[model samples]
Target chain A: MVKEKEHEQDAEAGSYPTGQKPKYGPFDIRRYSPTQESKEKRKSNVLFFVALFAIIMLAVYGWYWYNTPGGERQVVQLKNALAPYNPATWYMGKLSQAQDIGNVWSAGGGNETLKGVLFDSFKVAGSEEIPQGSPVVFAYGLKLANAVVSKLPLTLSCNIKDKDIAGDIIPSNPLIISGKRITQNARCRFNSEITKELSGTVEVEGGVIFPFSTTDAKLKVYFTSEEMEQSLLSADEGDFFSYLGIDEQLPLRTAYNGEPIELGIGVSTENEQPVVLREGYNPLIGITLNNRWDGKMLNLTEFRLIIPKELSINQEISQNPNGLCPFTLARQGKTTNEYRASEELIEQVSLEKGRLRSFECWLDVAPELLGSAQYTVKEYEAEADYVYQLPSRTATITVKGVAGKETGIGEDLLSPLV
Target chain B: MGIKPIAIACICLVSLFFISGCDMLPNSIPGFGGNDESSVGGVLSASIFAPSNNGKVLSDYPFKPIVKIKNAGQFEAEGQTCITGLDKDVFSVFTGCECKSFKFEKEGATSEFEPISLEFGSYTVKPQEGDANQQFSAITRYEYVTDVTADLCISNDIYEDCGADPDAGGAIDAKISRVSGGPISIEGVQETVSYTGGSDTVTLIFTINARKSATGRLIPESDLNAQCTPVSADETPKVQAAVREFPITTPIRCRDAEVSADSTATIICEAKDISLINAKGQAVFEKGYTVPITFSLRYFFETVASSKFVVS
Candidate 1:
């Protein structure tokens, strides 16, 4: 009855059943009534979750801000601020401002070494033998001392002493030099002490021509440097100055050693039109060099004569002591043969102005050119190169052949004959 | 608080970032903002459409070589196309002149759609002992004119403000408005305004330069025969330059312009005693007026294209 009464009391207090105990300890009153400590724990948990959410939001916002254009611009600004530390950047900056120093020097007296203009380099580049009726480009390089601060307008004019070779400088405009430096040292100091190179090409059309082989070409570059005193029209005006006084000319003679020489080659045969050749007959071929220039005499450095392979030289009649000229023969290619004059012989061939030198040789036509056909016409080619004259003349000869039996008639004629 | 609202907010932020990123990318996709015209700006562009390079053709058969030309720039073009390197002994003789003349309209927005083609008449290759490879060059010489107009600010008073800041030396430079795109371009113009005391006239000097690129050779329009061949030594490349229009009534005189070996020509135009007073007898010096100067340069430009074929 007492147990039943206790159960009734437990049920009235809303506790567990008679035999069951509470989940917390017997003194744990907080199960039935909320405690201050429990409330504090709940508050702390809520704060922790809120703080975690806030941290996550802050991270997302930070990533978005970093990816914006403004962030990229800040990065660029930082790089630009540190660009001065890079050597390449420093050098490039100095190069871009190379012309700016000219203004500074003009305002103040420049270095004494830069007082007068100086030509540093002058070079001529072209082929030794310039063809006739062809444009000859005279590539020249001019280096000027950095003495003048203002823009220097230079006019390049050329004159050929020989009237026969008429040439005019193309684009007769003046070359403007606004303190552009082609070469610089590590320090990038642009001044007269460091020569600045200005290279340009001056084409003289019809500069080298036929008949007028040798020419005394002179190139004159004219420029003026003067200190000007002018009042500024306004603070926002460009430096405007006029050129005063006569332009000074720097003459450069293009004639190296003596004068530029042009050589011409002519090939002739004994039988003129439609050269006829037989198995027994030998033809005489003449190679001539006409020095049309009326200038200094020059030695023939080299000469080459190429003939078709179907023909062989009559060495017995064309050798020295009896032949017109001494030459050594060699096979050139599959279808041609080359004849070159000896070094000593070429050195002795000193051609005076307006002179002609001829070398003659006899060629024995081979039966292979006619093959088994009678009265066959074949085109044979012969060329000559003298002193590296490029685009050598190629003479095409139509050979009319009559197939004839081998004959010993020309054997006696092969004897040394001048 | 429920997590659903926070999740939605995060998704919206991520979506906004991606949308903005797509906007920052270049609009290079086709059908978007791509241009149809050629990127290379020039008067004329030519290519060998027929006789494909390194292709083979039968001997003793007639074939035609065609060249496709396009007006790539904003100018009309007329030129002669010459075919070279065709061996005469190995091919049928080309009657009449070898060069064919063609004219093309100026490039418009849809000009790229209409490319002109030139057919070098039918030619039969002669039979050879064996197969031979031949190389051909199609040389096009076109006459093009580049017109440039620049607005210059002229002021009699030294203190009158004009264009940009004064150059390094306090000299005002002419402001160029437009330069037609072509092989030849006006590099820049230098203007000088000189005034003498008590003189109502102001001297205006303009230095203009015509520069050509390395792709073609510039020849004088007068030398029409030298178009398809190597420039003769006697023929200097010159441009007929004229000051077509000027603001003032004073006549402008331009010097003869010759193209240098560097493919550059400098022309100087001067107008002396240009009245500072208007026709209404009003002084125009108190405020600077813009003077539109127009320059027209006429010259012939030559470019070459090469193709190879095997006659088997």
Candidate 2:
């Protein structure tokens, strides 16, 4: 009755109230519909079209509303005004604080990425200086503690914090060298290990080297530097043009290790430094001690000294008064001892302790004979390569015995030329 | 006149107007509530005529795209080992470099990942020839990609007590990083724009021939433990998605898309038997429409359609 009324009213008024009418006013709705009613109705088609059309229009208007960077930018800024400031750029802001010395490092990159560098090349560009002391060394060594041996000053500084290293240790802390004196003082401690054995000739310095105890420690030493290299480099081993590395010369890193040791520009000393060469019995010419046993309790019988050829003294200048200087090599222990070679131009060559090897004696000439024989060539322990192509020049080296056995001229002790 | 005739005339006129005026007009749609001045070639963008394309296309309720610039530059190590200058191989690596951005645009704009070829030019460098110290390669290849990026700075130069101690009492000596270069500034875009009805896939690539140069210590000393390793060029590449609704698909046509001022549309879009393949390129999403994830949509229109709205 409601539908009939709706229809009758719809026919007259051209509209229908919500009713059970299948279709009305030329409308037909049915096609792939999701309902059995719509499939069967075959009406309300115009209803579907109208609904779809309305939906599309709503979409069109939405497109014109939001979604543009310009609008977004302003909106984002306004949002930020109400939010907290973000802290992300702080890290990138801290890269300019290097030690910035005029040290603008300059180098070219290679394909492999590692390049050769010269960090301290400019320090000693033009100067030179040598040390002081007797150059020949046959019996003993010097024992100076904590000393600086550098040509240029070095500084260290760090920021290494405790958190930097893995364990709680700080790593940023830099070690800064405040001044030259300070730098030297910090670097005086030298630590190295070297051992040698000598047999041919033995001479021991007395009283000076460790209270002349036979069982006391034997300390060895040496001084080296680029300056030393320049003086003691084998004159025949290199050419002027090839000094830095050619046929005979090796790389600078290699040359540094092989250079000989030297000392003596000239320094005044009345008591003399405690670095004696040899003083007791001329242990070189095969001597036998009878009174007391000495030397590290290990008995000093079968020994061998292996010095490189470059360290041997040549006979060419052995005759010159510039030969070598007077230094003692002794071994004073708890009893009487054996004798080597010494000087009355000086004192007795005491041997109350241990023994030394390959001894040589020299003297200071008069100012008148300065050019002829007034030099002191250091005598080092003789090695197999120390043979003078010429012959052993003669010199009068004195010696003192216990029994008062009258010594021969220069033969047994200073053995002058034949 | 009869009252029924009078009522019928009013209803017919209203329905007719509603049907005629609710058509999409991508090119001439006026602004809605927001201040969007976007247009393409002086033409207003098409309005979204279909109810299906309303909210965010991204699955996430809130979507964010992260961007980052990594290893901004580097110094190659081929030529530095000798007395003579660097070798040519070092320059080659820098010359034939690949600068890429991995991003995915709106699906119909872009979806799924694929390879993009790019060719950039080479560079030649000399010792102290220019303030630049090294020559950079020219971009020869370009590819657009999408990925999520993280903003974490792992500093390599900080020393515990020696480097920069923000919480320290003494002077802080540190090496900080400076973001000298990266993406350029973009002027805000203001032109009518429209994207097609659904998400689209897009892929654009181009080459940038930028040279990277840096100098400092690298291979650590022999006495020092654990040397620094070379940064890999191929590890952990970035992937991101970009979105752009081109005005082409969303045309500027002559359609009146004004929804009835009083009525809102309820749109329901289903998978409708999707024919898409998974990343493995296998057919997927073909099952029947899943229910109750009932994504409810609500929208309003401004027009006299079906007597739902009155004429102004």
Q: After best superposition, candidate 2 residue A108: deviation in angstroms?
A: 49
- Model 2's chain B yields a TM-score of 0.13
Q: Which consecutive 10 residues in model 1 chain B have the weakest lDDT in total?
A: B28-37
lDDT of 2: 0.21
Candidate 2 steric clashes:
145
Q: For each candidate, what is the lDDT?
A: 0.50, 0.21
* lDDT: worst 10-residue window of model 2 chain A: A253-262
| Real contacts recovered, all predictions | 0.00, 0.00
Residue B56, model 2: lDDT of 15
Candidate 1 lDDT by residue in tens digits, B1-312: 699999999999999999988865543321121212232665667767667666666788886877777776666778887765454434565432267778876446555435777888688877754656564566678887788898777765543555433343334667788887677888888777666445466677788877875355665455455433333334556676788778677888888687765668898888888777778877786666677888887778766565656778
TM-score (C-alpha) between model 1 and the true structure: 0.39
Error of 1 at B32 (Å): 32
Docking class of 1: incorrect
**How accurately is candidate 1 docked according to DockQ?**
0.00
